[model samples]
Target: MTSEEPGDSSVVRRDRFSGGPARGFLSSLAADERIFEADLAVDRAHVVMLAERGIVDGETAGAILAALDDVEAAGHGALPDGEDVHEAVESAVIARVGPDGGRMHTARSRNDEVAACIRYRLREDALSVVEATLALREALAETAAAHVETTMPGYTHLQPAQPTTVAHHLLSYEAAVARDTARLLDAYGRINRSPLGAAAFAGTPFDVDRERTAELLGFEGVLGNSMDASSARDFLAETLSALATHAVTLSGLAEDLVVFSNRGYVDLSDDYSSTSSIMPQKKNPDTLELVRACAGDAVGDLAALLTTLKGLPRAYNRDLQRAHRHAFDAADVVGEATAVAAGAVRTATWNEGALAAAAGEGFSTATGVADLLAMAGVPFRTAHEIVAAAAPDVEDGDDPATVAAKLDAAAEGVLGENLRTHVNRDDLEAALDPARSAESRDSAGGPASPAVAAQLDAAADRIDADAEALTAGRDALAAAADRLETEVDRRV
Candidate 1:
């Protein structure tokens, strides 16, 4: 070991190489603000566990914990300059109680401690994302519930392809977001496991009770292997991946809203829109455009995290320090984007006339026409060909009279028979009408009023289930916090 730097009070016990350029290079105090409270909680749990295990006396453990309370009150900004939050906190504790404060680090390593702190903090972040996702789904369902039969254009490759109700359009996005919520909640299960007692990547001889600390910290359980507990950052990667995917979902939702806003089919609230600096007539979907662009940042953050973790050896490394900003940044941005999306959906207005008119343009009901022909004894492909050929001559695809006349003419040319030979004019007219066409395709999960109403009910059930789960997770953590405080009081 090298010489100890006794003059600098900020430096913890390990002082072989201090005050070098590498010291500043290796510091993580700035990036550690998010985990400060987490570190304090982990310290309290570990100190309580150490006293219980007879590794330290109740007097020292209580003193260290009390000093920790002082350190926490001082806040991360007031922390002494150290290599990281862990060292700075330990140093602060030592300042309060002298060498006895050093006992708080007993039977634990920065390796396991940092892991535990990250998991503790990240579990809350994951749950927050879940909450945001459910909120967005609720907004979608509310808007959809109100417009179950409001006919709108559905598109393929951004070109109008069919007439669907506004409810169907919004519910599709809700379904995607519900899945994103599940992914985040599932990841939370993995993140809430404790890594605390895995001292420096190996078990210590002090008989440390990992599960006791885990329980105090609200972890579902302790990691089974000390080495794995100390080294694993896979939880971080999985969480970033989930957040990035949800960002992509939000991007798609944002894209649709941006496009609809441009088409005059939708108009977002002024709170979610911005006016152009020079163009007096312009109301830009700036929030949505940023949300759409956030996908790239989310993807980049995930990529950076995964790349940093690549090809590392089994234990903790200095490189791991660089990985957390990615997850933290992604979590914060994705949650904000999700909430903004929820607000935008809840407050936006839809143009019923524009949506209805656009819903019928571009031969949108031709598929329903073909389906009608098929039902009336014509081969489906033959019906499709008839409609495809007739579309060019019809002056207005939405006009049933004109579409029927063109289809009859095209059928005579294609099969030497009028479409009237297969289906009656009344049936043809219903098939060509956009409103009737939307209602006609009333299979399960379809765009019809009854189908969308069924979907709304289902969406309500899912939101309830997810909200209950969210509340359970939060309640469990709050209870754990109470238990931890009780333990601290007994020792103090």
Candidate 2:
């Protein structure tokens, strides 16, 4: 080992130095400024709580608050020359108050402080994720509304099965996104509880006002126990899980868009597609593919986080720090990817002719035939058997009108009721194609023009409500931040 220099802390070990090609540290680059901001919030509350509890002098608490306000004004708190976030903060306080800033840290440990910081950051980021989710929902809703009556082939087993409205298909994703939004909200609720009082794996001897700190910082409540607070990374893990789930959901939608954009099914907007560099004629749905790829990244992050935390026997460990990058990176990936998907949906185009043609080629109205037979008073199962036996003989590629005619004449003596009245034989043969059939279904959630219109109206209302809620939540957080800053200033 090299001799220790006058100011050197330790000799650099050659074994560790040459262990492998050293990667430059970007760990600190992932430092969530929101987390640092949260730390400031916690500090403001902590000083006030200390003063109220008589653990620290009024002047010391007051000075600490003022120093914090100054730190905020400067856009950073007391970070140290060679330390991490916690030490940096305390160092700033001492610089401002001539050693009194050091007292504010008395009852707390870095463990609890770090936990609170993460919670605050998670709360802030979760809201954005929710907003992105809502935006995606609205985009799908808009697409659904515009294409409600536009007919498309509904597939089962990758084969055209029936005619369904494009609006109906789009609404299916809206329903999915709504659930994702709810999941995020649930995750936010869990994230709201504060861990500030946990104090490094055990309760502190000091009579700390953890509840007061929690309230001052706008946390829902103090964590029930100290050890659990310091040791629990569940909040971080849970937030990532929510993000992963949303990513998976978005990926599913992206897959559909990719398939739809291929080979004349749906014409994706030029902005969302790209020409292959080598292929002379290729409009690749590269953007959609990216969204799908991002979902895989989100999933990997989720698994990586869980793996990082799984075997650690911990109140706190350096290894736990590794979890931060995945969480932060996944959040960014999800936010940006969701935004891209929303924009694509807003600008995408569909091929009405292609969709209608595809819908008609595979006896798309077979189910409707069964539906009509049931309506004519034959029990559905019997009607199904009768239709099933007659179906193969119904002529391949026959349109709904021809099928209706064959059914009507075949069942003339058996099932009673002018089937022709309910189904147009002549017009159904010529103009009443699958595209029109999709327009005719008007039941709730159906692809009928009127039903699709109703769905669009409902989706609009839901989108407005979700957007308002998100705005209000953000405003509340901002207000809390402002109030905390102001209160600290008053004390200083």
Q: Per-residue alpha-carbon lDDT of model 2 for 1-492, expressed as tens digits?
A: 113221122111223432233322412423645477777788888888888899998988998888777777776423433224565566666666765567988798878887888888878788888888887888888778677667788888877777897789989888778877777777777787888877888879999888888777777787797888887888778889889988998898899889888747677788888997799698888888999899899999999999999988967887766676687788889988999999888888888888877776666666666666577566788666655655665765665556766666655535554556454555435333676667666788788887777878877887787778778777767777777767676777
Supply the global lDDT for candidate 1: 0.89
lDDT against the true structure, per candidate, is 0.89, 0.75
Measured by TM-score, the strongest candidate is 1
Question: How much RMSD separates candidate 1 from the native structure?
Answer: 2.1
Q: How far is 467's C-alpha from truth in model 2 (Å)?
A: 2.6
TM-score per model over all chains: 0.97, 0.84
lDDT, residue 279, model 1: 90
